[model samples]
Target chain A: MRTPLGKVRNHGAGAAGTGHFIAQRSTAIALAVLAPWFVVNSALSLKGGNYLGAIDFLTQPLNAVGVILLVLIAFYHMWLGMQEVILDYIHRPFTKVLLLLLNTFGLIAFGAGAVFAVLMVNFGA
Target chain B: MAGATRPQRPLSPHVQVWRWHVTMLTSILHRVTGVALYGAALGLALWLMAAAAGAEVFGPTHEFLLSPIGQVALYLIVAAVAYHLANGIRHLVFDSGAGLQPADASTSAWFAIFFAIAAPIGLWALVTFGG
Candidate 1:
């Protein structure tokens, strides 16, 4: 049970503390498995290639799906990591709050843009 | 407590006060790489957008990536990723309640550092020379 002071100070997790921790790690584990594949495949796809070839490779259903997953998960993980870093290092309360908001919004925008790009490629739009 | 003025707190010991060590280097590198990856997200998004947008956009993007400066950037990013990934695995190992021994921890840090160097170099060797 949180008191008024706790609520005012934002002491509680707003029901997200444990879930955020678990999700960050889960995404990290997922990335650990996916990242090597991503790097290798990306390099291979681009071997002696031009722009259209790059598009062709990415638009393939398998590559498109893999990339979409990678972008979303990576951004989510990045957001969590950035939030932690900012909270740890930024001592000014106002600046910390601003940076935290920027981190969240910025990641969301990147994730949305990346997924949109992948979908555009997938659909040949 | 919320309404009262807070007392000034002592700053914790940081890198300035500490001697260099492999484990400390690894830890700092993890955070640094994490921040770099966050910035790289924008580059990635731009790459994807260009790809989806067609050759007019992707041509320049791909060209930049193959250029000397771009290749250098790519190599650094890849190195960062390798380090972060390898150290992340070490962290997971620690989380599992193993590798708590100082000797084992140092060994793992060295392993992570070695992997960070080797992974990108090995990857590029394959990319460049593999038939």
Candidate 2:
């Protein structure tokens, strides 16, 4: 009974559909490289769970920058992926909205805290 | 407003309905590993924060990471990471419009699962023997 335009108006695209898809894939690609690097480096450096070794590794400029980028991109990707999971599964109106909001704010806070921590280590602040 | 009047819609095939298949396992595992890695990511955040807090604060965290339970947790995290990484690459291939064939998808899923099993053991060997 509805017009074609009416049927499609609220359903298609949702404005950011393509953008979300692209960001998720692009970040996945970035992680594909960064993650392996991180795992290998951590294994080699943090042997015996050497705390000073970790500090030493993070203090290097390249390592510091890489960790920072990894944290930022990983958290951003997590935000996007978790949003999809939440939207797909969490059907209750109130819980879905609540989780979506918490997901965003919590990730931002954690991501920022991580980056700040890395910066503090690198800069001796 | 229309909710009360809307007819009940059929839902998509869910886990209980689908036949067991490698692709299905991979699909489910991709999400499961993703959630697991979400927790791992939080652990990463905590590690960074503790490291920043200086040796006095980081001591317990580091000790725990080296303990028996922590090592098991770390191994599981690594396994999840390996699986997620390999399966994530498979997904990227799927996104690129390749490997959509059932056989190919199944093959890749098996490969991912194999890699997940092998990576942690390989790392353990490298650390224990390559020294």
State in Å the error of residue A92, model 2: 1.3
Instruction: Score candidate 2 by lDDT.
Output: 0.90
Q: Which pairs of residues collide in candidate 1?
A: none
- lDDT score of residue B23 within candidate 1: 85
TM-score of chain A of 1: 0.85
lDDT of 2 by residue, A41-111 (tens): 87877787577898998998888998999999999999999999999999998999899999999999999
Candidate 1 Cα outliers beyond 4 Å, as residue runs: A1-4, A7-16, B1-17
lDDT of 1 at B94: 89
For residue A49, model 2's alpha carbon misses the true position, in angstroms, by 4.1
lDDT of 1 by residue, B1-131 (tens): 75468777776768687667778888999999999978877798889988878878888888898899999998888898899999999998888899989889999999999998998899889989995
Interface RMSD of 2: 1.0
How well does candidate 2 score on lDDT at residue B118?
A: 100
Task: Please report, as a residue range, the 10-residue window in candidate 2 chain A with the lowest summed lDDT.
Answer: A1-10
Lowest summed lDDT across 10 adjacent residues in model 1 chain A is found at: A1-10
For candidate 1 chain B, the 10 contiguous residues with the lowest summed lDDT are B2-11
DockQ (CA atoms), all models: 0.66, 0.63
How well is each residue in B2-50 modelled by candidate 2, as lDDT tens digits?
Answer: 8899888887879688778999889889999998899899899999999
What is the lDDT of every predicted structure here?
Answer: 0.86, 0.90
